[model samples]
Target: MSVHSWPTQSLRIRTMFASKAAEPALWRLLSIVTLLIIALWWLSAPRDLFSAPLSVTEIAREAILLSGVWAYVLLTLAIVVVMRWRWIERPLGGLDRCYRLHKWAGIATGAVVLLHCVLEWLPGGLARARSQPSADASRQLGLDWNAATQEMAELANGTMLCALIAIALLRSIPYRWFRKTHRLSALLYLATTWHALLLLPPQLRFTPLGALIGLSALFGCAAAVVSVTGGVGRRRRVRGTITGLEAHNGILEVECTLAARGLPHRPGQFAYVCFDPAEGPHPFTIAGADPGARKIRFVIKALGDYTGQLANRLAEGQQVTIEGPYGGFDFRGTAREQVWVAGGIGLTPFLARLEYLRWLGRRSPSVTFFYCTRNAATDPYVSRLRTLCTQTGVTLALVDSARQRPLDFDAIAAGLRDPSGAELWFCGPARFGATLQRAWRTTGLPGRRFHREWFEMR
Candidate 1:
């Protein structure tokens, strides 16, 4: 029987098995959060639950309240993670994974909060509507100041819910507008925290659950303050000047020399570069790093509004701020051979790795680099890449999709000295990576050996 035709094994099961090995870091994060949620729910459970029977509404209301608290905790944790703290990034696998978790937590928080709001209104909506005083009677009686304040707070909470849902669901919104609107969440979070503190049952306030909520709220507020003050990347940020700028086709190569201490970075890590204050910071992979010279290079494609305008607006000696040296795409582990697949701008990280290998001045592992480009003849970096590959003893395989077929696993694996033992490192479009990954599975390659850098932040 063929290896792909395992008896009684369904494709779904096979896919799950493969994913389990490939995404251990993500699984670890999910496991930790799941356990925490379960523990919190258990702790928050009422002691007299079985002693006295409660109505379905009572039970559901309690569940919704607990879920809301859990969601808030997760949201606070997500906020803390996004602060780009080095200590947190290391354990969480990388900054990319950290951001992935942040996005998931934000989405989960919005969903749970929405559910909580719906449940709160379900039991009382009709009764409240019928009992509300008439407009004339309300005017005659005058508004109750305390009730008015509570109503206003509720309105604010609802507004925040709508914003969170929109932020999570809408992807077409411009990043600048998205970022500016996202900052308002912190203020809304503060308001929600205040509301919870004032309204939660007094008996529950002294419990461990209450303490946890209080701490989370305090931490979230602190993070919000840091965010508002433009201190998100303050610790890691360094002033630099554009030492060189090179334009190739639609791509731009930028070199910066640091005014402060240089960031110690691994070969395949990335950094957030801020060239213009109005443009805001954008993440770019570090294509080269020279600690001695305090210089770093970035290869950026004209893919968006900020990057598109860079070639025209940027000039030598322009002051810039760089914050990071993030990501964990480094090739530190041992493998019999390495197969690197880079698609277009994804070649940035591999360029840095090749440079590092060249500096080593020793024959490294058997490396086959597949650079998939539109047209090899017109590729500006073709000669430069070939020179670097020669220096590092790497075999460069240029796949020109315009002339030939797209890259497939069979072609990539054919160059590998030991297909099973080789580690496959890919940096490219998500769909391209997914396709390659599926192909790898058909060949029964261990998913753990396939490493990919997820490039999309949104």
Candidate 2:
């Protein structure tokens, strides 16, 4: 069926349903489970929760404790998901999407933790000010190691807030410091676990809420152990040495030959690379892979401090560690005709796909590749791509954004022989992809037919 044949209402309905289906199933499941747990916890609580009048301080205290429980659960789940990304990558769509979820979970956890602290402390502060006579007796009664545990928990909470704020706001912080601070969260999490164990309301000890919290604590403990032992991505890590380096306008291509054991990866997947222990692991798409030669290549753009310094600091024989081959942006199981839109550095995955098609030595699919950049003349990879496209019989159009208007669905549809049957793949800035997706909506295209890779980790 042609796209033009669909009625407007039908198209709208189809798009609505497709968009709903496109939401990550794993994320939806996690969200539903979390909400269910929260509801159960509230329902299973004592009758006084809803039947009796409660003071503001008592209500706030309950809220603070509940929020802390939720935050710890989410934080632990985020750590487990991120550390074992491969397990969720396929179901979650891609590692990029998984990381995006991981980031959201982390931020949400931090915000809730902050809220818990404020709610717990504000009432105490006001109460102390209103009644100084009882403060001394209260202090005397609260003293001892349990009080110390509460203080330690508060200290850990403050440290976590500081670290999260620093990492979020200051990109220029030394990578080593960033990594250490990030890992320190695990230790702080352990401290909070202790606090929760000893200080949780005595009434909840025999209830389901307590069991759920205990399970979450166990999960968090296990994740912390894996993190502290550096067990993340252990199996995926492969030793390799840089064999060649090529610099292109603001991009650098590093070619590396791996050890005898190959790092199996599909086209359009990326890996986290660690060149220096201090610099930590940074993700880059695999531009090309040669299984026979046991070699893989990465196209890195000088967009940040660590990447900008790579060209200058990297040597030919420098050893590196690679951990992945993650992402599910592969163009398989789609329509025979595919439209691929790549923006600037976004071209890396397409290049990998093209290389894979060439290696397969079969007739290429009907693909229209629109490569968008500032200038086709100066883009170092354009010439290489042109040659590869010609040899592989893939249609290539270089769209110089400086000289031409941005690409729209109409422009893309002009080249498609069967718009309804063609899948659209996009990798670029999130805003650009959204623009094209909106355009696709008006063209009566199924939203599922549009595949986009979101590269933003933050």
Candidate 3:
């Protein structure tokens, strides 16, 4: 209910449209999917699909086959992405990016599945209009092997798949509702897997393309089982109790004492914290931690509907489930100097890094932190950040929007003694990060040197 908390649903919509630097992981995933599609299309599609003239019936048959291939590939990949396996997550640039990829894959699957269904209908509609004897599209297209039964089964499964996907992608839907309904997708995947196994052309059934699909289905089904059984991230989860909770400005600083074992987390990683089982877990950055001590802290801004209620629902001594120690935003680089830019709640990770550096007693790579906030006097973290910077020998700049112009490339570049040599680490609103990233790219800094968190995962 706090005015400062960003609405979660609106933020999710903004994240979908907000521009940022292209993720290498996303490009790599798309490339893999494209290559697989081409391989499958070449192996299974009629050799004369593009070479020779084709009739409407033949075209419809080919379109249906091609669209089915795309749906299978994307939907399978989407299932695998949600397994939350660390090895897979690390290659995909963290679990957040994996979820982003999952969302896109689901959208693409819905589209291709829709196309497949339409193609299935086209030939039947055309034949009926022309007064042909065949009422079944599969029979007219020479795809009939118990055609009526197959078509009904496909229609039932495809309709369910599309409905589930629509529920997932619509930002207007509540996340709790989405979470509950989205699990049905695994069951839907199993249904589609069965449909594919039964309907695939006999000629291509034993080919390499079929092998690829078979493997995708196997992995997807396994991931689906892991998800349905609530085993995803089970290995990483640990039980903990809330030891302290304090409200600063509109943010909550939650402290926890791990009851099981120490969660060895890097400076800038985050965790999926489940305060209430009914609400599920939400990701929060590890604001501070000591590897040896069974203690951790999270600075949370009530930016969404679920998060807004956390302050009231949580209390000291409350049992909670903590899964992770995920993310790759740790401020490690080879630059002689580091420029850190944090906007509002984005300061959490930087605060963690500063605390870590203070513990290490080393400030070899000089750092200047630009902390962006609305008001210096009202923002509680400003004083704590100043003290940490002093302890760690980091220079701190408070970029108060109320008193000064917005922080821009010029202001950041002016602070750096060598813009080209210094690596920039940023976390903030997606649009702000995109703006800064676009400006930074012009400086000829290698893209890898500019690090930021892709924190949105709706």
Using TM-score as the measure, which candidate wins? 3
RMSD for each model, in Å, please?
8.2, 8.8, 4.5
Model 3 poorest ten-residue lDDT run: 126-135
Query: Best candidate, lDDT-wise?
Result: 3
Model 3 lDDT vs. the true structure?
Answer: 0.78
Number of clashing residue pairs in every model?
Answer: 0, 0, 0
The TM-score between candidate 3 and the true structure equals: 0.87
Predictions ranked by lDDT, top down?
3, 2, 1
lDDT of each: 0.77, 0.77, 0.78
TM-score winner, 1 or 2: 1
Point out the worst 10-residue segment of candidate 1 by lDDT: 126-135
lDDT of 1: 0.77
lDDT of 1 by residue, 349-414 (tens): 999999988887866548889999999999998888999998888889999988999998889977
